[model samples]
Target: MKKIITLFAVVVGLFAFSSCTTTDDNFQEDFDTYPYAFEIKNVDLGRVADNEYNLRSTFQFEINDNLRDDETVLIYRLTSTINSNTPVWQLIPRTIYFNNGDLVDYFFDFSKVDFFITARANFNLLNRREYIDDQTFRIVLIPSDLAATMDTNNYLEVMNTLKLSENQVKKVKL
Candidate 1:
């Protein structure tokens, strides 16, 4: 009876350890880093106070969410097909680092957008009754680890065509 009981205990311990061991199948899921995320707080466009020379409106992007890792944030100005008559807002690279603390603020000066688009928009507003071209933009947070290995060209090529995960897509409209 003693021998049988000792053997049973040993068998149970072995099974427990084996179940917890890291294996190839579960390695990725267990050890992969969590994706970075950003919750855009205030998405508003208005004039900057105390700056008379700056006639163009200021677009303020306030992100109040905490991130797990430093990420390269991609901001894109959607094409006309996606958001009709909207000006191409931006095409630039901005990185959000962990050291930025609980909140990060990024600003885009609308004054830099193409003159033609702004001119046409202003003209339409004056000529056509309450004609304002509503625009939408997209922000994608790419984790540094995945971004380092990503095929950027391919990703940009299929940006609109492919279905991106909800966790990665953030939208701001004007």
Candidate 2:
């Protein structure tokens, strides 16, 4: 009788261990979806301060909720349009030197929740509405690891690397 009880206990233990070892078919691998992009069209930059000559605008970037310190924020300007209405995009922190020898710079800064696009120049932009109005910009958020592998200056390359279509990019207005 004691031998039979020992055999029953071993059988139960084996069954329990076998059940634990079985793999679940429903298990799935985790995919990291980090990069995202957006476009703001025909927006005007507001004056940064009462007396300051710098022009600026604020944009809400909700995706930066978990933004790491090393992450990248890329800004681009719609420099012009081509024959088929294709946009010619130029990366920002761009300097435009005027025929008058004055230069204006386009750049931006970002925080966890938002970002500010600013235009600064050696000359006053108060009378230069053309430089501050109807501006279009594209903002891209990327992980530092991914940013390190690509040619950031090439807009089409960046777009392709991120597998982004024009329809995938959300259009925003200010």
Name the top lDDT candidate. Answer: 2
* CA lDDT for candidate 1: 0.35
Q: 14-101, model 2: which lDDT tens digit per residue?
A: 9976653322233221113433688888887888742223334444544555566867889888888896559999998888988989
| Backbone clash tally (model 1) | 0
Cα lDDT of all candidates, in order?
0.35, 0.72
Clashes of each: 0, 0
RMSD of each: 13.5, 10.7
Per-residue lDDT of 1-174 in model 1, one digit per residue for the tens? 999999999999999766643343222221123222222323332323211111132233333232333545454433244355333334322222234232212333222221111112212122322112233345444544555555543435324322244455443233
Alpha-carbon shift of residue 28 in model 1 (angstroms): 6.5
Clashing pairs in 2: none
